[model samples]
Target: MSRLLSKLSGGQPVASAPVSVDAHSLDPQRSAEMLAGFEAADIGWFWESDAAGRLTYLTDSAIAAIGAERDALIGSELTQFLATGDSDDLDSTSRPLKFRLASRSPISRLNVTVQTSQSKEIWWEISATPRRDANGEFAGFHGTARDITKSLAQSRDSERAAQFDSLTGLANRLRMARKLDQTLTAFKKSKRSCAIMLLDLDRFKKVNDTLGHPAGDELLKQVATRIKKLLGDHGEIGRLGGDEFQILLPDMDDRGDLGDLSKRLVQMLSQPYSVEGSRAIIGCSIGIAVAPYDGIESSELVKAADLALYAAKDAGRGTYRFYSSELSQNADWRQRIEDDLRDALTQQQFLIQYQPIVDAKTHKIASLEALLRWEHPERGRVSPADFIPVAEELGIINKIGEWVLEEVCTQLSKCPPEVRAAVNVSPIQFASEDFYDTVDAILNKTGVDPARVELEITESVFVGDLERTLKLFKKLKKRGVRLSLDDFGTGYSSLSYLRDAPFDKIKIDQSFVRGCSADDNNNSALVSAIVSMARALKMETVAEGIETKDELAMVKGHGATHLQGYLFSGPISIDELLDRFDSKELEFKPRGPEKYRAERRTEFRKIGVIHGDSRYNVFLRNLSKTGARIEGLLDVPVGTDLVLDLGDGQLAVATVRRSEGFSQGVEFETKLISDGDRGLCTRHRVSPYQIEAAGRPLGALTNSAVAAYTTGSQSVPRAFVEVDMNAYNRR
Candidate 1:
């Protein structure tokens, strides 16, 4: 190596060509052959100058590759060959900045270009190490510079695929989390806050089950694309795992931020996803947890979000819930309560409380409203508000509601002669096919008057599939039972249900009654308006939760005929109630409670109908006639009109008010009659009347004001008038 270096540099050799080898007859040719073998490998060789970063020794291959000789590279500095406008300082600084000694820090691996002496650029993996002298002092560096241009190109491609979701082509979860961490760090530095929302697709399993896995996959892809476009760059969104996604909003600050984002996400996700020429709606419930508010740690934030998610799902899927400490507490309580409820149902720990509905006119208990009470052995009393929804969710409402109906019916049969009973039916129970049969069996077994029993359902039930609900309602009405809408105005803007179905009464929600009082902020005019609406629908209104004297007066003044609440009675025991009713004593009565009886009008009228199989007859029986009876092979439904063919073949319309198998009793349509008939009806209605002392039965009278014209002279059976089908059926 010494002889070669001296020959190559044209300088004096420091060693005398190995004196020992020369004394022992060493071969210079053999040394030359060994040096040739070392150079034949063609590894890059270079010598650096102290004044300038110049390559003094360029191998034959290196010289040919850069189109430069050793002399050209020696005089020229490497910085001179660097691309124009590119900073040497930047290139030098970035090399070390690309990595930290610690593995915990983010790795900044990069592939960069550097220029050669010939002004040609090249890419390399330049890993450097210090080349020290014998004294181990500062020395120039040596590095393994591999031409990694092809490998770098392939790595760039791999990185892109790793960073983006293949289906949506948006950022994948890994990239999203990385970006979220950076954003949160920056936001905290600026003293701002952001929100993290977790979204889950409700009933997504149904889609996969019914639509197949391919369709499900397609739906997910389409939803991803839609949500990505909707969010744009204001937030980072990614698929966390199967039908679940997460969105991070770096700019959001407060609860409003979460609420607004939740609403937007819900709205965006509400639309149908079209895939493979088919459409499906994927509803998402968002659980929001705000950074620096809900939690500071990412894992804590995610847990809060998950808790809220369960809350939204519990409330009913396809909604949103904001994270709160209460949500976690409630979730825990709900879990325990759910377990307890299952046990309670099995153990029969629930009971019903009957609330008497006094007839405003009679001041007597006309009906009892059966309300459920949870007899939780340890917890004392839980309001229906607390557990009824839970029961509904757990699918125990049907059993509970059935128990209420049957129990109320049985109790009603044991009550005094005129008291009826009303039980509240859940929408879930209403949806059951066996509901009618169960109700019928209860009525029949208890021997309770179907006319005296009523079922109350909330308006939300009717709001859901109107046609279906109407059909069910009609079936109930046909069985000689009464139907009422409970909490009418509080939910689902008042629909014209009275006109569509035979709803006997409408119970005004406590909200309106509470609002009518002095302490309440609601305008009295609004109460009057609701009353007016109820009146227009021809439905009686019963105001619930009337407490104060002012509230009672307001309710009565607004034309609410019947009232019930804590003011009237706080659901007394049946025995206690019977004692009060038997003694005619009022313990929990209101100040103006007596006024309700005196104010009710008693100008009643008995409506009568006579009909055969094909033709029909209608009559308005006198109000004084108490011995009314109906009979025949008439197959008219309860609400169908009965047209009596008078001698002139005129049509006097009457409604089939009530029915008993083949026999039906009808009520005259006073407003629906002709002006002449209306005058006649009105005159007769006001006429002072007494039972005529005739040779007929004491209670029998053919009260058909006008004779009916029949094709055949078939005498109307006046003998059956005093039988009283309602009374006979009671026996």
Candidate 2:
């Protein structure tokens, strides 16, 4: 009976002596409940056994990190849940397993990749410690496992972000810089060569302005993707901001590689991209600076590449250029010229010459085109093509153009009244702020009539800022001055601008005029077409560069209304022009038909007093009490304002009935005209002294004394006149 009781008790498990004294003495359920609370607190609590090298107890966090259920991990070997070869070999002896066990120093860290029971992979930072019995002997281990997948992913993303552009998800300039630096280093070490290419999209500003910035951004993105696909791991590409991109070729040996690559890039970029349903094609100008050949350093390479970029752009865009020493030298010279041009505009080094524009019908020079002359102190005469573009690019053309306008207007005020002048304006100057206001100020200063002043713009002026151009043209047209298109066949010379643009005259390009006398079908057809189009549009056509009589005849044959070239006179100085004008009367004679009668009355009053030819015969019929009936063979219009000098200090004004041609009677305009012993002086035509003595009409000249002095007839002195000419005239 005792043996059975002992066996049953042994089978049932012996109850320990109930040594519970304090109320806090924990039961197994209470201990398990405390561990559950630790799991709920996000603390990974785990225990390993020495016998089987397996996890015995694991909290919820440990189980979740290990990605296994508690029951699955409880008695299983920890190596099954861990990465392979992570377990220590164990013996039958219940000693601690020999392994690279992390020390149990509170919270610790271990970098490792952990696999879950469901074959899920993750990164982990584990902290483990050796568990000891009450005697401090190593019994097993306990540890915490933290999932580091999110942190690792974040780190990787940060790394990638540093190397890429945030806007386009492409490599950025910094990445490009670093990559080029690495490439150069490699080239130096390996004795191999490479190329750095800089790309600029042609006319990208037009895209930005016409399609809006959002569309521009979409276009840039598409361009980036296309470039990436073109490069395709063969090279590196980077955005250097605003339609500029950089490409690095790390191991390009043959120059053909660069050529092939640039060709491909251009081809790809030239393909049309759809932005907001608008198909737009973008083309790139690529400049390549070779390594160890063009430059040794990265910065130098990039600079040379940029110079090559500008070279491509300068060569009319949509092209590629290789860096060379001569190109660099040329770039330096261009920069210096630009600087000098800026200073020249401020330093008053520019002057103007007037080229005569001969009337086709009369062969008389009626107007002079103002030509820009750069009297450089050092360089002498710089060509307009050389410096004008530089001035335009630097935005100094506005100031220079205004200076020219003011100077030309002042000159015109001093010139003969029959001669009008035209000044050329750059596109930049035309687009200037307060352009019309500037013109008004100049005209007011110089006292020039708006009708006598003309402005000429090259064909390039009409292509930019369409709305602003329209507004400006409308305002200028209201001012009654003529605007002309100079060099009509050059540079974006579209017929649309000719029809839409408010232009009064078209100056056929010198290229056309040089070939005007040639009998070639192409040349003759071009000139004829320009003239015919101008005639149809009611725009006067002026043929330029007419150097010979044959050229002049050719131009006239083509229906050119005006001609300006060496055939009439080359651009001459003011002194030279004064020598050219003969003894002539320049009068502001109104050409309207209504003014013909008054002109007849004046002719009748000067009939016997001013005898020249019987073709200009005039007769006074009846002397009335208040007015005189003038009978003349002159056909004067009815509304003509005539200044008639009667004898004995009496003068009268008149209108004519027979004003159209030489005919019969005409009536007086009024009883008030300049009189006093001042009969019309003829026979010797009109001498300056006689006109000044009688204080008679000086014609176009408002001041008689000033006119006489200017005509080299009167020895009068004026402070404003240039001194040398007056001193010589007095002698």
Candidate 3:
């Protein structure tokens, strides 16, 4: 082989001959031809631009791919033919392609989109080096470009898959978290507000269990669609997971607007859904938290919204709640209640109270409605509203409900056979597969006639499996038990169900009864319509919550067959009821407040009253929309203006209207609004912006934190002098 190489080397000096190649292959023209062939094959293309960013040259194949002639593309501005890529990595420090070109900087593997008249877009990965003349004067950019459209699309699909939920096609938890973080960071700099609402579909688990998971999945999709339709471009909605959703609304801080939106969302979500020929009804609970108010960080804001959501659910599903600092404490209390509820039954913490159902025409006691009450040993008479839901959540509601049923049956046996007793049933207990058998066993054990026991069921029982609900009603009716629909108009109010369900009586919801006396209220018309319908169906109508004479007269005029409420009697113990029956007090004379007034919650909370640099510790005895009654300030004269610092940033400027002894009735300058849980709160609260301006963190402000905006102001003229109640007492 060495002798042959020496012969091929021309036989002159083969000792140090360099590696040999074909002479034709070494020609510069042939090399250039090979490079041109590579370009024509679409492996890559060459591009050049002048110092003015005008395209000087482009490969013929590249121009052909864009459906343009080389001559036409040559003089076009580069930016006119290509745009900067929308890459996530483009940060604050990144420069645009035009700026890079102007600065004569080298760019490597920069992804760009080619502008074209074609319907389809083309993506190019480009690498370029800025060229200069001998004098180092900026000349142009010389670059190689490659088509990366297919790879870019694959990348984008992967990114979308990672960010969006597969089931509902909404943003998943990871994406939502990142979006919240980014939004909060950006909004912090602009000092703009953002609201985050976290919602969970109520009874969704029941839907999943009753129907298959596929139906639940379909329901979730419909929920997402409805939310998008209602929100449109107002916000971004995401399904965090399995019936839980999060909404991001930017630049919205108004509590009134938030409250309305929350209510609308709940209502919209509560509408019945048709899933695969099966009807599914579910409600939603919303918890809303605003940026720089509830929290400034993403995690903190999400937690606040979650706590608010829990409060909404605890208040009874199908409602919304705005986050207050107290919600966290309430959440802890709820957890404690849930723990305590597990043992409530065995500990005998529950008792039954009966409220009389009177005949509207005769004003005579017709029957009694049994209500469940829980008296926590430590908490002292815990409201059923506060603990029944906890029992339900802890899966002990059925047990408690069974106890109530048995106890009510025993009490009904004690009452005269003519006086019947109505027992309230929870949807959970009513929907049990063995509910019919349970009722039969209880009746057999107590030896009470079924006709003397009316089973009162709320509208919620009609939510899932209507056929089954109708069958349950049939079974109960077959046992000769009277069936009554309780809180009739407060829920779905489906006329279709009312048409088929065998309801012996229809009870008007207290909400309607509460406002029936108002001349302008639509509740009167609703009650009239309900009564007319019930009469047509041969069913009796019972007006609930008739607390005033006017309300009683209105329902009676509207043709209500029976009346039940405080006007007749409060809930009494079974012993007290027996005693009343023994005393022959079956005829109830209506005795209640003369007029229907705003609901005033009775509470005992110590709060601060600021009057001209003096902060007095006073006990708030009762609070209402227009005024509050406070004690501990003796001899506070009328017309004295004071700032009431209800904790959690609620500041009310009130003037004492009535002063007697140590108690004062003060009217609010601005009426309070519903706090979403049967409580009253100021219409407006201390703004986080003010807190920030006061050099404190943006959140629910402490009294000291908000004092700068409220009592800290010294410019206001004093209306009255501060009186030391303690000093007067000492004297």
Alpha-carbon lDDT, every model = 0.58, 0.62, 0.82
Error of 1 at 290 (Å): 2.8
- The sequence of per-residue lDDT tens digits that candidate 1 reaches over residues 1-731 is 34333332232221212112221232556544543454455442222322224433333554565565566665565445322223421244453322321122222222345455445546543333333345855333322233455665676668868887776666677887787777766765565666788889865665575467888888888778778787888787888768888888875644544565676777777665665665455567778766655565566677888987877766545567766555677877887778898788668788777766654544355567888888889888776755776887798888888777777777677676666677888766886668888888888887888988889986545432456678878888899999888876542443455578778888887767764655436646667887787788787778787766677778788887677876667786767866776786643456444222101123223333434423433333322111112354245567765543322112345666777755556555542211110111121110001121212222111233223222224554432232344444468
The TM-score of predicted model 1 comes to: 0.49
TM-score of each: 0.49, 0.47, 0.91
Q: By TM-score, how accurate is candidate 2?
A: 0.47
Off by over 4 Å in 2: 1-171, 178-237, 247-293, 308-347, 354-369, 382-395, 413-421, 458-465, 486-497, 506-536, 540-731
Clashing pairs in 3: none
User: Worst ten-residue run, lDDT, model 2?
Assistant: 675-684
* lDDT (Cα, 0-100) at 326 in candidate 3: 81
- Per candidate, the number of residue pairs that clash is 0, 17, 0
Worst 10 residues of 1 by lDDT: 674-683
Report the lDDT of model 1 for residue 356: 60
User: Residue 137 lDDT in model 2?
Assistant: 70
